[model samples]
Target: MSLCYCNSQKSFKDCCEPYIKGLKNAPTAEALMRSRYSAYATHQADYLVATTHLSQRALYPKEDILLWATSNQWQKLEVLKSTPTTVEFKAYYLDQNKIPQIHHEFSTFVQEEGIWYYVDGEYR
Candidate 1:
């Protein structure tokens, strides 16, 4: 059983994969944030794009996203805070140079028609 990348103590299939694969929708902003981290870890650019708010899509051109997503070796993810529409998390990973790094961000999300979408984030 492949464990999920989001540090959720759940199988990939039982955790974020369902959201990434469109089999289900994330119920909260924190869930969406975790799933997005899982998408980045797994190099699922399409899922990342699909879960992004339409207005924010243009900021992340596919090539740039693919480049970043493919270059990282994701290690750990920790959610620091969450609200109805925002979540803060820290993700640890290795860069293309194999240097360890941390990504800490406060993310905003929105729900439209019962589907949650990532809006933007502020890096820490």
Candidate 2:
């Protein structure tokens, strides 16, 4: 599908493909957030955990996430505001059951060495 971010110039496959496939690293929190959204859309659980903070990595279940992704369709992403280690955005999508949903949240992230990691998020 076409993406609203990146000026709608690229499909999720072309724009965030590397990061979603665990072939490329996300250098920033916002970039990781974007790639994670793409991963969810594509059901790439391995990529999700790979980009997450090591401390919190255990909180996620790869299989469960894969199942959840199968039932959802990611539609759009909006990074309303962001800093080097944080981001506030709205992610829009539709559940497989066809329910539309919007996750508006302020997400916190941290960088260790040179890798960015998702810390937590609060709904807004």
Query: What is the clash count for each candidate, in the order shown?
Result: 0, 1
Off by over 4 Å in 2: 1-8, 11-14
Q: TM-scores across all candidates? A: 0.96, 0.84
RMSD of each: 0.8, 2.4
TM-score of 2: 0.84
Model 1 has an lDDT value of 0.92
What's the CA error at residue 8 for candidate 2, in Å? Answer: 5.6
lDDT of 1 by residue, 92-123 (tens): 99998999999999899999999999999999
Which residue segments of model 1 deviate by more than 4 Å? none
Tally clashing residue pairs in candidate 1: 0
lDDT of 1 at 108: 93
- Which candidate leads the pack in lDDT? 1
